[model samples]
Target: MGKADPKESYALGTAGRGLDPRAERSRAAALAAASDLLIENGWAGVTHASVAARSGVGRTTLYRHWPEAAMLIQQLLAELFQVEPVERTGELRADLIGELRSFLRVLHNPKSERALRVIIDQAPLDPRYAEVLSACSCKGTDGLREIVDEAKARGGLPKELDTDVAIDHLLGPLVFRRLISGQEFPDQYVPELVDSFLEPLTP
Candidate 1:
């Protein structure tokens, strides 16, 4: 039920250091157990007691580290959503296609997909989750921004175009296709969609 090789950086960062290896294992086990709990039971199912029972890491330890569901969720997200920055190939169409392909790969993983669903489900009702979600989002935003900036500098896109709107135009469809449609076409759909966007833009 847990992700294989749970990331210790997120745990170490959130809880602070100075723990023995055994203590680190206990913390990582708790986080992994909580992640499994989130996937299996969603937000409502995860509690300090539940995580303690699942991980056998003790309720007091869960309370000491996570303190609340939001904090625990924050730690989980920090580990799960490791969005990498996009590398530009100097071609707008190619860069965009690469971006979508990369994003789709992340979404293709069932564990990551479930984590996103949980965050999206909670962000509306909880400000803490919203904050964490925003942090994750900014990483994506930066990548798109870079692609757009590079495209504009190369005269691939109009100089006067609103970058924010452009980012939406570029990323919105792939996101919509995956999250809203609940459909995935990571291989065949990427290029067709990229071409569809660029056809109107090209002079």
Candidate 2:
């Protein structure tokens, strides 16, 4: 699969670009096909023409929206793993636990796990995919950073605390446990991770 062409830049939207339901469905179908192929056959299996065939969307429409297979894969990931807004419930501890739990839910899902593994394996070979993966990661990282910034602003955390490092500590263990160890990253693990990270920063 080739990288996204330098001449064409695709915006985040459906294939037809207008406010048409049919176009939206086609786009969703195409994305689902790409996601499935990536999960099942790895990055090499996903291509513009293959996705068009699998999705039953016309090649013209697929190419019109995503010319490159990498582009399709990137959009597929964006659709699958949406970066949600942080929920601040006026309680830092509760919010922290809630955020990590949401993360655990996604990481524990088999489909997402498969996609992540494919992305990780493909990153070294495909620079385009690496950029896409980094962008996706930034979405989650930025959301977590917002939570840390908000907590620090409210004096819940130490003023000098590094939000980036703080976020790494908060999410890193879950990633290790889920991806590295292949163990069940249970719900109960969320509280302990959140509390331990907060304890030192809190007081």
Candidate 3:
């Protein structure tokens, strides 16, 4: 499918200073372009020049914000999943379900899912991309760990629950189905999945 053109923005001159609204629009366009390239052509396609051409931002501006493609990829992944932590309601099951639903939504987004697949597929080829993937994975792990910690403190979860293993249990299957089988996790499955994971650990 043909992608839409990037929005028009005021070009920042060499002497431009202060909060240039155009700069924000340019950055947005660059990110959209980079993500599209990632999904369409994989990691090798997301260079500064390619992004600049697609985004209509100058090379100088793209380079000024993102020195490397890896950095740009990192930002792309980060922005796609900028979901806030689910509110803790002192109920472990409900809280976990809330977070799971949010995560599922992000993963199920077509662009985000495609971008993630590209990153994983290219990680073996480029050490820089491997690092970016690791960083993004760590962010997800940390968020899951926080939820586990909160649940434990609330006196419902098992103290022995290994947060790392628990996180893997929660996310691994969803990721497998999304990336490998290319099937969406039905919305009705959220509570079932959450219950299954919690049943083994919740006392």
Candidate 4:
């Protein structure tokens, strides 16, 4: 067989320019297809070929954009978890509660929970997945850090406590209970966790 033309391959799936309605539609279709595949099959089943087949987009189109399943899944998470930043209400207790509740909501979703478990389980096998998960954690941790900083600024945190460690102390129990024990995390537990951390912070 003769050599294939690289330019022809590239042009076959190229999205049109700005204000091009067809290009916009194609982009939306690709994203939606990828997201549905993730929700349905979790991380392991979301290959670029599968996504392209599901989306009706050529493999070249999918490769030209995402190049990998992890990248596509990460993009999906970023879009789905685009929560509004926690507003500083000047009340440390309220702020902490609000932030934690928001995080819980994200984790409690069955789809999200399954996706997270898959990613965590697969990370050991795939370095790229591990990197994707780490990046996602950093993004999430930044939000938690803001809440902790706000609490400190408002005098709700212990003077000598380390913020990172304090965050673990505050939130770690809930994660452990849910992820390890496979128990439901009730809203009532929020106040208890907050109180446990707050008592030490208060003089």
Order of the predicted models by lDDT, top scorer first: 1, 2, 3, 4
Give candidate 2's TM-score. 0.80
TM-score of each: 0.84, 0.80, 0.74, 0.76
What lDDT score belongs to each candidate, Candidate 1 first? 0.75, 0.74, 0.71, 0.66
Clash counts per candidate, in order, are 0, 0, 0, 0
lDDT (tens digit, per residue) of candidate 3 on 64-146: 77777776776676555444466666567787778777677768776666656766876798775576577667655666678
The TM-score obtained by model 3 is: 0.74
Number of the predicted model whose TM-score against the real structure is largest = 1
Span of 10 residues, lowest total lDDT, candidate 4:
8-17
Angstrom error of the Cα, residue 101, model 4: value is 0.6
After the best TM-score superposition of candidate 1, give how far the Cα of residue 192 lies from its true spot, in angstroms: 1.5
lDDT (tens digit, per residue) of candidate 4 on 1-203? 11234333222122222424665576568777877877787766778888888889777866765666666665555444433466667677787777777667657775556556666786698765576566656655677787787667766675566888977886677667767888887668887788787876687
List where candidate 2 sits over 4 angstroms from the true fold.
1-9, 12-16, 19-25, 124-127
